[model samples]
Target: MSAPGRRIDVCNGDADGLCAVVQWRQIDPAPAELVTGLKRDIELLRRVHARPGDDILVCDLSMQRNLPELLRLLDEGARVRYFDHHAAGEVPRHPGLRAHLDFSPSTCSSLLVDRFLGGRRRAWALVGAYGDNLSDVADALARGDGIDAHRRAQLRRLGEAVNYNAYGEDERDVLIPPAELYRVMVRHQDPLHMLQREHVIGRIDALRTADLDQALSLGPWREHARARIWRLPDAAWSRRVGGSLANLLAGQCPALAHAVLRDTAAGPLVASVRAPLRAPRGTHELCRRFGGAGRAGAGGIDALAPGDLAAFVEALEAGDWG
Candidate 1:
């Protein structure tokens, strides 16, 4: 028989995206073309050159941003299964497309895939959830699913390490490309096994510790009663640490919203905004004002003009988070 058409798996490079695809492939093993990029590379769908009879699986990336490409893929006679938690505008009604999407602030794409798989890989799902900074939700799921505290912490650390590996201005800053990481990931049914047997996890954990330590040494560039902002220079370290630092600061001061602004080489700022953990709202609202979009709890602006940093801070400061 002629070789079957290609099966491509495209996803965001973060832990949530990786774990989601990991779960799916674990349940249904197949050889597929893997397309993914760093955390900031959300428009990944455009990279796919799918032909008729090809199969595509997209995870953790935004449907809103990839709508046009999605429509085009359907027109080309490909079968696409999309799983995501990001903002999805109107979903097209196409028989070839199978969409599993949730825009709720509490959900992540991995958890959605876990739901689809009937919790066969709950451990991996928790890892993805923790990586997305849904600590509380992941913890609750762990508890409900009978995962011991020790195992839960291990999963959390693995999640954080996997997530850390996905950051950086580009692939060079990351220790391993996510596609390669996924190949290593799929070989094991349990993530902890990967942690115990593989050197990759150790390398990632060490990098995360180093990046976080550097981030901790810096103080807030601007501070207000309800919000805080940290300005980081355009460097590999800053790009690697930006989102993780925002999560750290939010955890340290649950009542204060946090924004980590990394100066880009193009003279603009890429901002990661996290609403107060105590009140996880208004972040998406704030980012939307500046031409960015994300969930309510965590959102970002891809490029904030130099003149608008002050205005962005003002909006975060003045917002009614209650």
Candidate 2:
């Protein structure tokens, strides 16, 4: 006995996650409530409260992070359908759980959803790959589908725009919320159509690029093999530019790990770090020093007090890659 009519969809508010749900709903069209937040809000299943006989769809979040909440939901009688490319520590066998989990470099939740939906939404799949920075993978797939290089570039740009929009400190820093963007996007069948017509994509790209320019204008940390840190003044612009800063630093100095540290509201500094893209390592471990966490390649700190800035800088300047 599966639940009917009581449906809830929850996913990370990034392009990959939302597009994953888009593919799913296209395959199984139904009206359901959506629970979503920012790109950093991947642990959203914890926020959902539902009774037994409810059908919940979750995507693009770590099952390991959501384990406790997932168990609670199942115990409360909610059946779950989960799709993800993140790590899932261990899963319990239960009749009520349906998981479509894949952890692969070329895959995102949207691509997985497209696969599950029998490739009915391949266009969005390209978008997800672009968002996830899987350019080689995205380019190859688009070519396989006989997409023109120009169209492949368009999808890549759309992917970058969509991915860029998901960044920022929180909801206030974004141009538009992911849920609202999803609403606008779901009206179209092909994302390539979006590439041609949607102004939101251009706005997002322009905003992100402008912010990146500002960050680059701030100059470099001028350090050696140690971590490179750029201190950002507290501003709405800084908040919006955080992700782009990390990316810029990563590309500008591929051999060194980078951190973009910005002042927050309460006098503490927030930081986003990226390991060497070509040799990504130790970022997660390094961020742990400031009470943040992420995977091997990227991570951040929630807050670092004023006194800690110098120490943090010293640590960054002395970052040991050896």
Residue-wise C-alpha lDDT for candidate 2, range 1-322, written one tens digit per residue: 7545489999887777878887777667788888888766767988888788999999888787789899999988989999887657698688789999875444677888878887788888888777765666778888889989988888877777776777777788889998898887777789888767888888999998888888788876555564677878888778877766786677677787788888777988888887776665566567677776655566677787888878777776666543
User: TM-score of each candidate?
Assistant: 0.96, 0.85
Evaluated against the true structure, the overall lDDT of model 1 is 0.89
What is residue 211's positional error in candidate 1, in angstroms?
1.6
RMSD of each: 1.4, 3.1
- Runs in model 2 lying further than 4 Å from the true structure: 1-5, 104-106, 252-255, 280-290, 304-322
Q: State, as a TM-score between 0 and 1, how close model 1 is to the true structure.
A: 0.96
lDDT string, candidate 1, 92-168, tens digits: 99999999988777889999999999999988999999999999999999999888899999999999888988888
**Which prediction has the highest TM-score against the true structure?**
1
Tell me the TM-score of model 2: 0.85
lDDT by candidate, in order shown: 0.89, 0.77
